[model samples]
Target: MALPQKKQQKSDATAARLSALNLPEGGAWAREARGAAKARVEAMGLPHPRDEYWKYTRPETLVAPQAPKAATFAPYESAVFGDIDRVNLVFVDGVFDPARSDDPAIGGVEIEPLAGVAAKDIHWARDLYGVLEARGQAPVERPLAALNTAYATEGVVIRVTGKAAKPVNLSYLQEALDTDVMIHNLVKVEAGADLTLLENGPAAGRLSKVLEVEVADGGAFHHVRTQGRAHERRAATHIFARLGKESTFKSFTLTVNGALTRNEAVIEFTGDDAVAHVAGACLGDGKDFHHDDTVFITHDAVNCESRQVFKKVLRNGAVGVFQGKILVTPVAQKTDGYQISQSLLLDEDSQFLAKPELEIYADDVACSHGSTSGAIDEEGLFYLRSRGVPKAEATDLMVIAFVAEALEEIEDPVIAADVLSRLEGWLHRRRNG
Candidate 1:
């Protein structure tokens, strides 16, 4: 379905405003890419809250008329990765910064800023640049995706060669700036390749909007994402992955800070033996405000497996939301899919919502989903308190246990320890209060 004529006019206005801005210096190809993107945005109108898929998210608030233009490159402090060894590509204000980045020369991995690649090397981007926008017809229309296409100043592109055994880690840091920033990152993992990607959002700022990702056949991608945006910042990320024959994709997101944050992951299995596992945890207190997690899995091929699990803890007036759906097509015979979402509300004022759905077309396939929301087990709390434990400490112990299920999926012990340590600190503060 196409957008209405009125919405089309609004998109045209957006394009006109975008065209008036001065873009960074680049070759004819970059100019052409930008032009094409602008035209695409013009053709696809803004997505509204009325759209079924976006009913929960209002785009108007994010796409205000006076929204800042695509920000220019600016000097900013770099994120400290400490001793963790990984290929780091930094982008400040949505523009790649090589000076602030550290490129670890790992064998079998090619890491470079997308803008640095030759026109010929970016054939993949040309082919798949707008693939997500085209495939996004479900509830129909994503204004944020359209905005990314229109204003994406720079991006990071990583290509892992076929059958490359080593994993490539990517850290996306958005620095705090006076202006809001939008990033549209396109990642491609080739067939028979394996990659471990770590995507970290801006430490603090009003960095807002969407991010899209794609994975190919025989490709394996593991992602660790952490969001620690400023209290005034509101951010939303949209991750899309396509798995080929015998491919595997795993992802985990940790939301530690943000006034309002929503992270969505969409995965499609197009070939047999494809597998996907997604897990996430949200930690929030009084001022944290809102956190939403959405995961959708589609099995289009036979003999594919998919699993999704999400856990959240909310205290004070903080709110948590989880929505997971699994779809198995008729051709997806012998499909195995499972999903579960559980949340613990620490106070009467706190709120949690869990929604799980299953759509199966094949009778032979096995698909199931479950969701639950409740306060911490009072019986368990009583047992611990009766054993001479402080009530606050006892509550913290239960919350830790609830989140441990998702945290255990982190394979790297050092990374796991870091996450655990952060959790401990958050708990300590809550107990003291």
Candidate 2:
């Protein structure tokens, strides 16, 4: 059978991209996992502008054979989450840096670099490395995630057996402008255990990262991520999570500035009474800035609850996009799902695009979704101005209030405050300029 011209072109581009990279070598299980991921990427090819989901954002820079040059930005403030006490794992140019990292001997948790674990004959990651990613390919194709699984240069595998006293932080630093990073991380929470993961950094000039998390019954997993303030950086990140009965999964992301960013989250509730929440807040400025958040939540068990909340503030022709969906199966009676994506456009030149969907097979389930893009509330702005607040300061204050709802999704109050302060700093700098 003859293939469509566009499809053939995409496949050819995928081949060319794969030929440019040197796949890492590992043990039999690792090899098998990578091989399967490689096949999946080949079959799906790469994303194109014509694709339904890709229509809002262009994938040329991410899929090109050569990475687009990105100059690192020197920020006015220190690193995020620096004040918090955490076990830090540093990565420079996609490779783990032990000298800059704390010892991986945290209590109640086992952490090992993916490179070392992949070389072993048998490990717990063998069952999780690419399993969730493979399963997330249904209803939509994520070729970038498959590519990361096939050629990831570095990452970590974490198994939490009991409640962790402190959080584990993954800090990425980009020392080279042309570095292209591929990282795949795995997290497993055993029954009745809990873990929190913190991620912050400007990974590289170009980055593709995949995180697979599995939570057992009565377990909890919390993740807070901050994409760095690299104005020229480009990144594609995917999170695949499966929650067991009576488990909890919560994730929040704060993106300050980037030339391009696409964040995707696929979550499934496999056990009754499970809870999952995904949220993000982004601030974009300038004509080249672009951000996208795509989330899909599936309710396969009874009495499960899920929520998706995302907010973006754009100005100076920056663009924002959101695509979210909630699915309820016949068995998922008494399910509750809520989704909201809103954008505050500071200028008429900026634009926000959103696609919200809900598909339910259960009559007893309650699912609702809403997307809105508008300017700052005129009454609120006027009230602040009437109180003798400067226009710039009043706008900034309103912006903070607009995004506070999404920030509330953070489970840790201290972490939430830190994020709030960072957002303030970004706005302060912009106002001063």
Candidate 3:
């Protein structure tokens, strides 16, 4: 076995750069939890532009402490799950608002605000806070998440003992301008339990958030999130999950518009016969919009199944990036993994960059990944135009069709329809603008 190496010397320059952000401390947090997370961030300095992981997207804007000036735009009417029935919890500018949110207890699920039990000696979240974030550090570094752990203002912790009667919704209202928000959330689904999480709206003008989840044996966790319509907002978010025997975890995200947004997900399958899937659909239009998705999934047990599907629509000088990977450990025999990332560019100026990787140590594992980028299908566009459809309308329909393939991965019919409506609104605005 390889012995762990000693910590290296920290550069003064790197230390100075990190210090500028005025990272948060563990004032009300558990002492041990706070110390360990702070230590991790101290050891893993911020990623520099020259770093391989940050070469595609610049990190300076994300690491900075100040919320850079951003223009706020009107939100779409009753966006994301407007027609679905669910219990809602609202967070405005990263602070939980009870008056605007729903009750904590719903059916068999119990929800608690992290701020309420933050410094308490006894709490269910003591073991989960920063636990998954630390575990996900291997093979790749997540400095931003570490920073979030070291200093985050607020978030919610949810525990599901039995099947939830209704989906729990997180409605983020970004009403304040130039707001810098950081949050960490924890979720646990006990054995034989089931829960669904719905998230929507722009969290803030500048937001850094993390969610840690544990799905016990036979537990199921489903999540669907649609980022807000604020074209000038900036966000960096992470979702970490661990699955036990026979458990299932599925998450899908639809990103309509943002000035600069980067979302990262890290998932680990620890028990045999577990299943996991993560998918995203992002549409970026106009010069200032940029969207990036970075995902990593690890199979550490036998008979585990995992999948990744991502699609991006870019036009009018918009930029998109997708970095995804799947890894199977030596003992993870008979693992099944699939990954695909595709992009559609409407014009010559739009751009999409992708890096898809699969690393398998087990010989019996089945894994495949592919990436493709191209303009709209000319044949389909011609056929639509031949039907007396306007050229612009025909192009928009083809673009929508391209993204529909990825949207179909969403299982919930109502949530899928909500996403479709948002997509239609975005396409309409893009055409008019």
Steric clash pairs (candidate 1)? none
Q: Which parts of model 3 have CA positions greater than 4 angstroms off? A: 1-29, 75-77
Scored by CA lDDT, what does every candidate get?
0.67, 0.92, 0.84
Candidate 1 Cα errors over 4 Å, as ranges:
1-44, 66-81, 118-122, 162-175, 208-213, 386-388
- lDDT of each residue in 111-195, candidate 1, tens digit only: 6555664234335565555466446535434445655655555666667775444444445555445456666666677777777
| Best candidate, TM-score | 2
Where model 2 places Cα greater than 4 Å from the true spot, the runs are: 1-3, 75-77
lDDT of 3 by residue, 1-433 (tens): 2212112222333465456654443334455676677678778766556556776777777766466886566644365785688889889888999998877678979998877767576787877888999999987988888878767758888999999999999888887778888888889999989999988888888888899999999999999999888878888899999999999999999998889888999999999999998999999887788898999999999999998999999989989999999989999999999998999987899989999988889999889888999999999999999999988888889988988867887888888888888888778766745
* Best prediction by lDDT: 2
Error of 2 at 14 (Å): 0.8
Which is the better candidate, 2 or 3, if ranked by lDDT?
2
Which candidate, 2 or 3, has the higher TM-score?
Answer: 2
Tell me the number of clashing residue pairs for each predicted model: 0, 0, 0
